[model samples]
Target: MDIVFDTQQEAADFYRRMPSSFRQVTGVMLINSRLAVFPQKTADYREFAQLITRYIIEKYEKKWIMFIIEKYYYFTDAEEKVTILNIVAAIFSGEKDDLPHTGTLQDRHETIMASLEGVLKEHNTFSFQSIIRFRLTAYREVLRQYVEIAIDEYKLEQEYQVFVDKLRRIVHAYKPLCEKIEVYDEHPFKLFDEHHRLIRNVQSVRSFYPLLKQWGIEAEPSIILSLIALAPKQVIVYTDRPEHGMMKTLHRVFEERVCFARRTLHLGNGSDYSG
Candidate 1:
């Protein structure tokens, strides 16, 4: 089904509200097609809309034939539109084995041209190239936008991979290098700072930043690995989140050297450390 936008503002508004997923490609195509009546627009939006529409049509030709048919009706001459509809119906009406090979764009295009030629022979007036010329001229901008989106998605994926690799390295760095040894701590420190007490209302990574600063650690993995390397005979963790990832990593690295703190220190409330 097609979503008709009667005004440029309506189409722009719809596009803004659309989700940035594959599903939005259809809306983009519909909006761009409806806005085809407007002129002097940049190529980016047109390229994006047409590229997605072409890809979807290629991948699921049968599923999208009706949609394409509807879109064409709005822009094509009556004779050309009739020829396209007849060609589509004739190609899909036959047995599945008679369908053209769609292994590649060339194959699909050749299949479509062959069908078009066969149908056009009856009228002796329409050519596949003529219809394509109109489409290419009308949707040239869409092709440019398609290229831009592809590049953007590629860059985003690379960034995601880099972040994931960083995390993996941190995990691997803390893994035991040799047989486990008992740690001896000369200075036992908790995750709390000298200025703040544990507030039950807060729950976020930022909440621990001040505490980490007080503990003289810059990174989460740094503190955990540092505590292990310090070889604390007993490292006391005064945290309610005993099952936290950092605590678990510590236990895995230090084995029996890590211990849970039995007392709570309210450094934020001006409480004195008895240790």
Candidate 2:
């Protein structure tokens, strides 16, 4: 079996990184500036195909992703392109979880491996570039889907940053209604005064509703609205789930004013506070 590369460097790289077991059975040579791998034993063809499949996935996958991004999408800002690429990398590496329309990187690898193995079995010598361009349609489609997901994620991240910036501006401009407030994270979220007395009259929060509406921000959670209305100089939240979405928003908006205590809050009657 023979596998050919377009560039001598790529050929050298594939040959250099070949496992010792495979290296013992294969010989590499340069032909017309292209590298070709020739395995001595015909029985080792399957193993050689598997090795090439892995090499393509591990070394050349990112280059394919870059090609897809550049060919299909146009971004004026270089940084935006870089950001999208980073998101694609995260998704491909399985660092980003629970993606909607894509399989795990391992799944993609297996799919490509199966396709490549099928092609390798039928052909004794093939150009690696031609194989990718003509035979890997399914793999390319998967990559395009990944690029789309990355673009979507990048847009959401940009919108989130804008929202956070607007909230920070609002928080900075608003006067404090109280010196401090205690928040207990619950279904509805419980608010307490500085003395740990439950605050029942959150109707005061309605006054700030119109201000947010004027800025095209509306229908936010009541806890978030109340916190904005109160605009306390300090906010101490008692919750084990500091990574909650609401907590992240509060921390982003309040910056130095928010503190988190990672423990459940128990009221005096031995019942957990419920809002």
Candidate 3:
């Protein structure tokens, strides 16, 4: 069986990296600008296909991904393409730690292996590039879908950064209403003054309402609005779920001004202060 690849360099590299046992059973030689692989034994065809498939996945997957991103999606920005590629890798590896909905990376290896094995079985001589272009339609489509997902994620990330930047500006410029504040991450969310007295009245929140409206920041949760409104110099947040979305937003917006505490906030007399 003979497998022809587009570039002599790739063919030579593949041949050079093959195991000695496999090399003994196969012949690799350059033909013009292309390279051809010849398996001495018919029994080695399956192994050869597997080797080639693995090589493509390991070395050429990123290149193909970039190609798809540029050719189909028209993303010309190098940094943007790189970010999307990283996202694709993360999706494939199932390392999207917080995204459990993106589905598993099952069958990707088996799918490509099966496609290559099929090509090898049907043809004695086939161009690897042609197989990738014409034979791997399903695989390429899957890659396109992954790219779409990555692009969506990238846009969401960009929007989040913008939102965070706006909040950061607001936090940085505003004067602190108090020296310190403690926040309890409960259902309704609670805030306490530096004296550990619960701030129950809406007066402080009301005071910041106009600023929030003026800055077009009314979409944020009330707790975030309250915190930003108060703009405390130091914020101590008590929450067991620090990985929660709201907590992350607080950390991003406040930076060094925010600290997390796992224990609950103990208020004096548990009474609400109108102040």
Candidate closest to the true structure, highest TM-score: 2
**How far out, in Å, is residue 4 in model 2?**
2.3
- Models ranked on TM-score: 2, 3, 1
Which digits, one per residue and each the tens of the lDDT, describe model 2 over residues 89-193? 898777876777656433666667667766666777778888777777777787788888998898888988887888788889878868888888876787887
Q: What is the Å distance of residue 215 in model 1 from its true position?
A: 22
What ranges in model 3 sit over 4 Å off? 20-47, 97-101, 104-107, 186-188, 206-210, 218-220, 241-244, 264-268
Q: For residues 172-239, could you state the per-residue lDDT of candidate 3 as single tens digits?
A: 98788789988888877878888878887867667766776676665644687778877799999999
Error of 3 at 152 (Å): 0.6
Candidate 1 residue runs with Cα over 4 Å from true position: 1-56, 59-124, 175-275
Order of the predicted models by lDDT, top scorer first: 3, 2, 1
Where does candidate 3 clash, by residue pair? Answer: none
In order, the Cα lDDT scores of the candidates are 0.40, 0.75, 0.77
What's every prediction's RMSD, in angstroms? 20.5, 3.6, 3.6
Superior candidate under TM-score, 2 versus 3: 2
